[model samples]
Target: MSETIIAKRYAQALFHIGQERSKLEEFESELRTLQEVLRNNQALYSFLQHPRITLDQKKQLVNESFQSFSKEVIHTLNLLLDRHREEILSAMVDQFLTLMNETKGIADAKVYSVRALSEGEKKRISKTFAPKVGKQTLNITNYVDRSLIGGLRVRIGNRIFDGSVSGKLDRIERELVSNK
Candidate 1:
C-alpha cells in the first residue's frame, strides 16, 4: 500500500481512540510536537530509519525523548517503530489533525496580506469566509506578503479567495486581453 494510505489507516485508528478517550486535542498537540521534532532533527530521523538499530533501542530513545507525551501517543510511536513504519509518523499526524478539525467543524486557513493582520481582522475574515467553506470557524494563519500590493488573500483547503490588488489587476488585464 502507498504511504499515504497506510498513514490514513493508522490515523483513523488513532483518531477513534482519541475520541473514545476524550483526548482528541491532547493527542493532536502531542502528535504535532512529535512531527516537528522529526522534521527538524535529521539525525534523529535517520536514527529511527537506520536498519542497524534494534527496535528496542529505538523505542527506548523515543520513550525517553517523549516522556511527557500521553501514553496513547507513546504507545503509537512504539507500535510504528516496531513495524518499521516510523517514516509515516508525520503523515499520520497530519491525517489525524485533519480528522480532528473536520470533527470540530474547523478549517485551517491561510491569510496573506501586505501587513500583519490584527486579531479583529482575523476574526472578521473567519466569520465572513468560514461558512462559505462549510466550516463553523477558521484557524487562520496570517502571512505578510508585500507582493500583494494591498488587500488580502484567503485560502481554505483547495479554494482561494483572492482580494489582493495584484490579483485584481491581473484579472482586469486578462479580461482586457481576452476582449481583443
Candidate 2:
C-alpha cells in the first residue's frame, strides 16, 4: 500500500480508539504536540529514525521523553517504531487532525493578504467563506504576501478563492487574450 494509505489507516484506527475512550480532543492535542516536537527537535527525530538504534532503545527514549502521555499514544508510537514506519508519523498526525476537524464541521483555511489580517478580518472571512465550502467554521491561518497587491486569497482544501488585485489582473489578461 502507499504511504498515504498506511497513514490514513493508522489515523483512522487512532481516531476510532479516541472515540471509544472519549478522548478525541485529548488524542488530537497529544498528536499535535508529538508532531510539533518531531518538527522542532531534529536530534530526537533523527535518533528515532536511526537504523543503528535498536527498537528497545527508541521505545525507552520515547517513554522517557513523553512520560506524561497516555498509554494509547505511547503504544501507538511503539507500534510505529516496531514497524519501522516512523517517517509517516507526521502524515498520520495530519490525517488524524483532518478527520477530527471534519467530524466537528471545521475546515482548515489559508488566507493570503498583502498585510497581516486582524482577528475581526479573519472572523469575517471565515464567516463569509465557510458556508460556501459546506463547513460550519474555518480555522484560518493568515500569511502576508507582498505580491498580492490588495484583497485576500483564501484556500480551503483543494479550492482557492482568489480575490487579490494581481489575480483579477491575470484573469482579465487571460480573458482579453482568449477573446482576440
Candidate 3:
C-alpha cells in the first residue's frame, strides 16, 4: 500500500483504540510528547529511524526512554514500531488528532497571506470564516507567503477560497485577454 494509505490506516486504528478505551485525550498527549521528542532530539530520532536497528534493540530503547508509560501505551508503541513503520509515526499522530477534531465537528482552517496577520485580524478572519463554513467551531492555522503579494487564501479540508491580490490580477488579465 501507498505510504499515505498506510499512514491513514494507522491513524484510524489509533483513533479507534483511543475511542473504545475512552483514553483519547491521554493517547493524544502521549503521542504528541513522543513526536516532540523525535522532532527535538536529532540523535534519538535517528536512532529510532535507522533501518539497520533491530526491532529488539528499538523496543529496548523505547522501553528505557518511556519507562513511565502505562501498559496500554507501551503496547501501542511497540505494535507500531514492530511494523518498521516508525517513519510515519509522527504523521500518524497528527492525522489521528485531525481525525478526532473533524469527527468532533471542529473545522481546521488555514489562512495563507503575503504578510503576517495581527491578532485582531486573525479573529476577524476566523469570525468571517466560521459562518461561511457553516460551523461556529473552528481551529485556525495561519501561514505567511510573501509570494502571494497582497491577498489571502483560506483552505478548509479540500476546499480552497482564494482572494489574493495575485489571484485578482491574474483574473483581471484573463478577463482583458478574453474581452480582446
Candidate 1's displacement at residue 3, Å, is: 1.6
Instruction: Estimate every model's Cα lDDT from 0 to 1.
Output: 0.93, 0.94, 0.82
Q: Give the local distance difference test score of model 3.
A: 0.82
Please write out the lDDT profile of model 2 over residues 1-180, one tens digit for every residue: 898899999999999999999999999889889989988999998898999999999999999998888899889889999899998888899999999999999999999999999999999999999999999999999999989999999999999999999999999999999999
The segments of candidate 3 whose C-alpha lies over 4 angstroms from its true place after superposition are none
For candidate 3, write residues 81-109 as lDDT tens digits. Answer: 88888777777767887887777767888
Candidate with maximal TM-score? 2
Q: Indicate which candidate wins on lDDT.
A: 2
RMSD (Å) of each candidate, 1 decimal: 1.6, 0.8, 2.3
Spell out the clash pairs found in candidate 1.
none
Backbone Cα, N, C clashes tallied per candidate: 0, 0, 0
Poorest lDDT segment (10 consecutive residues) of candidate 3:
68-77
TM-score of each: 0.92, 0.98, 0.84
Query: 83-172 in candidate 1: lDDT tens per residue?
Result: 899889889989998998999999999999999999999999999999999999999999999999999999999999999999999999
